[model samples]
Target: MENQEVLQQILKELQSVNQRLDKLEAGQGELKDNQANIENKLDSVVEQTVDLKEFKTETNNKLDTVVEKIGAIEAVTKENLYDIAKLKLIK
Candidate 1:
């Protein structure tokens, strides 16, 4: 009778261990799914960062061109002002 009780207790402990293992397996599956989702989000952020860098470079190039054109206009305006002043002095 004592041996039967021991066997029953062992069986109960084994079942409890099995339940714990099942819970751990379920948790591992959820962790894997969450990891996959996080990786996908990271990939999207990397792509957007690349796009933003390219846009910034293009904008900087456009700004540089505009500055160069403004410099040219200023030089021409100065030259025209000098000519107008000399013409007025001669008159």
Candidate 2:
């Protein structure tokens, strides 16, 4: 009778161990899935950052070109005004 009780205890212990191993496997799978999701999100964020930087550079270049054009226009306007004033004085 004692031997039978020992056998039952051993069986119960093995069942508990199997349950623990199953839970561990499930937990590992969940972790793997979460890690993959995090990596995908990280990649998307990195791409967006790169795009923003490129856009900023392009906008800055366009603004610089516009400023240069405005300076040239202002210079021409000044020269024209001077020429007109000199002509008026002579007349």
lDDT, model 2: 1.00
After best superposition, candidate 1 residue 17: deviation in angstroms?
A: 0.7
For all predicted structures, in order, the TM-scores are 0.96, 0.84
Off by over 4 Å in 1: none
Candidate 2 ranges beyond 4 A from true positions: none
- Tell me the whole-model lDDT of each prediction, alpha carbons only: 1.00, 1.00
Q: What is the C-alpha RMSD of each candidate to the true structure, in Å?
A: 0.8, 1.6
lDDT of 2 by residue, 14-71 (tens): 9999999999999999999999999999999999999999999999999999999999
Clash list (residue pairs), candidate 2: none
- How many backbone clashes can be found in candidate 2? 0
Candidate 2 to truth, TM: 0.84
**lDDT for each residue of candidate 1 in 9-58, tens digit (9 for 90 to 100):** 99999999999999999999999999999999999999999999999999
